[model samples]
Target: MRQNFILQVILSILIVTMPVSAETTIYRFTKIIDGTGEALLARDIAVESGIIKAVGNNLDRSSNGNLVDMGSLIALPGLIDAHTHITYGLPEAPKGNAWGELGATTREQRVAAAKRNALLTLETGVTSVRDLNAGGGIDFELRDAINAGAVRGPRIFTSGPGIHPANDPSPEGTDKTTPEFLKAAAEKRIESGADWIKIFGTTGSADDLTSRAYYSAAAIKAAADVAKAAGKRITVHSYGIEAVDAAITAGVTSLDHPVGLTENHIKAMKAADIIYVPTIDHNRYYAQHSEEYGYDSNVRANLRVFVGRNIETVRRANHAGVTIAMGSDAVLTGFGENTCELRAFIAAGMSNAEAIKSATLNGAMLLGQDNDLGRIKVGYTADFIAVSGDPLTDINAIISGVTAVMKEGVLVVDHRTGGKVNKPNCGTLY
Candidate 1:
């Protein structure tokens, strides 16, 4: 009897400790966009064990799983935000005190606000995000929590604390801003579970809207070398022509917010196969919400000029065949509204299909997740969103028509029948 009891106890322990298998789910869509700029087609996708098992016209119904009939909806691979600050929210600006708003909130309050922001982001069909920076390693904790299913945010690739100049909000805290110090900063981020490293190659919008290179070519290369050796990618926050040129020459994976990129800069980015994420929406948001953010007249005027110039820059880069990826640079007010950047790309002369690819396959390429996360194919992760109408004809449908979202074969947002459905009992989604 004692032996039987021991055997039962051991079996129970094994069952409890083993990873639980995810339920197989079969989703049938009326129209499908594979994220390759392909024409939409009718298809049925079968997902088993959180991976796409098959995708075809008629899949076998023999598999034991939930069959979700997404009626007459246009399906596309889940959207990805190449740049985001998930830990920040729209601050209630006191009179003439934009910076002080952040100081008023406690760490716990900021984290809780971040969680809320993540859920809103997912609801907009953004299944993946690259969180560039957050203070005190909160971004890392948020990423881990989402991955472990402890929270319900997007699949996050984070840089815990970015390497910035002393004038920036989150500086590297190094004694000297040299090549060696920058490399050490990158290494520290890697040791802290950073999937990528972000370096501020130029000044920020709040400081001065110039594209002066903060880090020299040597410094950028040193940081990039360290990240590459560790099998990680590096992106640079650059706005000026000099900074863009230096970042591209240093072999950075992507150059974020290259507002002052020239013809030479575009050519170099193309030659190096470096991605250009012109976060036009970032400036647009600031300009639109200038009064709310307590921006003075000069600050607001700078934003307006930069917005137009940035749009022209994007048009020039796209015309020159530079690879472009959409990043909202969405911080507080633009969390769930990240898709506006895609529309900006369309306005910059890209076709609707091209703009969509910027947010989908191009984003996957930046993260080195092209084979698994960006496309709706056999053996890919089951990450997709459904909309009410075809996005090809009216691209605005991407933002307005999101109906259902599924990540890893599990439904997270269902807005059919005009009622929003978030994940029940899911800490992050709710």
Candidate 2:
């Protein structure tokens, strides 16, 4: 009796600690945009253990898994939002002030906002995001929760909080504005398992669009050096041209929200190979929803003007061979419209294919996830969305037409008839 009891205990322990096996599934689509401007028609993909095992037609015969035939849907690599502050206050609860509305959010509000944004973002077909502006180290907690499956959200590559001065309210707390202090701050973020270091390079946002240099070149360079030493990438948020030169010198991985760039600045960015994330549509969102934030008409008008400037800058940058990536800079009510930045990219002279690449391929490259997250190629993760129309010709097909979303081989959201994942002759395809 004692021997049998001991054997049962050991078996129970083994069962409890055993690794869970992943399912292999086959998904057939009408067409596929492979993220490299190549569209494969009538493609069937085999996903084994959440990774693409094969991609071709007639994969059903050789593949052994659940077959889900997405009928007449155009498949594409999952979209990526290059910039967001998903942890900010809720969109439903608007408390707009002079210019410091974001600073007054409570911890509870911040966490709740993140939770809501996560589901909305996933359903919108964005599989991954680079969450930049956050406070109180909440971004790290949110990222970890998503990775551990405690929360349902897009894959997050976060920079815990940016290095900024005391006056910057988004990141909470005042900091010594010295280079050494900035370097220490970067190390602290790395120790907290932050994926990137961010520098608030300029002072301008919301109704105020000034591009005054917030940090000196030495300070930005110091943080960038620390990030590089820790094998991490760094980015800068410069609302205008004032800090472009310093960002270039710091060798940051990407520059966000710079407008009114001279030809020389564009040339420098191109030569440095720094990616420019022109988030023109974010201004549109802010302006369109200005009433929600208690913004007067003048503030709305200013936002529209900024959007024009942003678009103009992107036109010049894209024409000058500067690599451009799509970033929504989504906050508050902007979560669902995360991919709307693609429309602005098109307006800035990028073709539909080029804009799609910015959100998929370029975004994955920016996150250092090009090998795993951006394409439908074999060996990449099975993260793709089924849209209703051909995104190659019409950009709105992706911007507003994502019908079904699959993340890691799991059908998370399906907007077909009757609110079901399996459509008629689609899911459960024998």
Candidate 3:
């Protein structure tokens, strides 16, 4: 088993190093579900130099290129995880068996752990991610590495760190955090090459489910102004409705993890075009793995109740025509289960098609890459995943059925039979 794992890692290295060529390649699928619609069309996708050249029925074979016939597999645009902490923790077991394992490593170990996470994240078919935070400029560096082709992982758009009182930059004269301090933190993140700014507008997660507001409406608006002036997007994390009004008033690009939103907040968010990233699955993950966090029975029960409230909030939002994006809020044990949030979307009275869109077009729109990343259309980047079942009928087909993956026209992961391939998790992990 050890020898096979070693060989698969070596093979993955070879595949990642493979060069791109101008020669066209064709991938024929049983059915292709473009993110724009509800129908699954049987189509062939042609690629060259990592860009989709053509997508149609029975693509021409006159141009000499490789042709891969994906038997009994359906295709969908590669998924985008709108919220993640990909750099926060390691996928492997901790050196010590406690939640501190999340932050137990040194700088070097953190970097190494992040690299492992990058690969593992790709193994789950997430081609792009909007990482919410990784303090100390680590997320920024990871994004650069992946962009430069030095790392074999998902495309990362990161916020280096969030504007939180827990970190430095508090007001010198008073104990309370001010608008200036928050705005300055946003500027620093933009200066650090963050594509997005994260605002820790509420204090909740892990064992506690309190919905305390971390910033005033003015402070959040000040930070939002900074992000807009710098041409960067911002997302606010609010556990409940405590920070929703402030987030809406600030005009944040998205709001994460908020539940019990009032009718006013919902209407305002839709009016402002603010996307909602519910991230309902992360709490479920913590509740399920209570031992790791030393979460008591009460905490677990609270988490379960929170998930139900979050899903109900989503139902109301969806009914009101507000945009919803899928976000797993993946950390520690949550990397491979990144797409699990789609299940929550389905449970929230969304059809399977709508749930899939939250990960595809909806997520791409939130990331401002709708044209290139969301659909299997001509002239788009060839980033997609193939699964054994059609996601239109069952959301799990997209969540757990990804069998092959391509990023920028490179066949990075293939887990089909005779798939003697890929990483620490390899074929078995999928």
Which candidate ranks first by TM-score, i.e. highest? 3
Query: TM-score of model 1 relative to the true fold?
Result: 0.87
Order the candidates by lDDT, highest first.
3, 2, 1
Of 1 and 2, the candidate ranking higher by lDDT = 2
TM-score of each predicted structure versus truth = 0.87, 0.88, 0.90
- For all candidates in order, the CA lDDT equals 0.78, 0.80, 0.81
Ranking by TM-score: 3, 2, 1
Error of 1 at 114 (Å): 0.8
Number of the candidate with higher TM-score, 1 or 3: 3
Work out candidate 2's RMSD over C-alphas. Answer: 11.6
Poorly placed runs, candidate 1 (over 4 Å): 1-23, 60-66, 90-96, 167-175, 420-430
Q: Is candidate 2 or candidate 3 better by TM-score?
A: 3
lDDT of 3 by residue, 1-430 (tens): 9999899677644433334334878788888888764554446788898898776655544455567888888888888999988877754664435467766667776787787788777877789999987877788788889888899899999988777777655657764457787877888888878899898889897777888988889888999998999899999999888888888888889999999999999999999999999998888887777777777888888888888999899999999989899888887766787887877888889988888788889989999999899888777999988887888887778767878889998888888875632222211110
Query: For candidate 3, what is the TM-score?
Result: 0.90
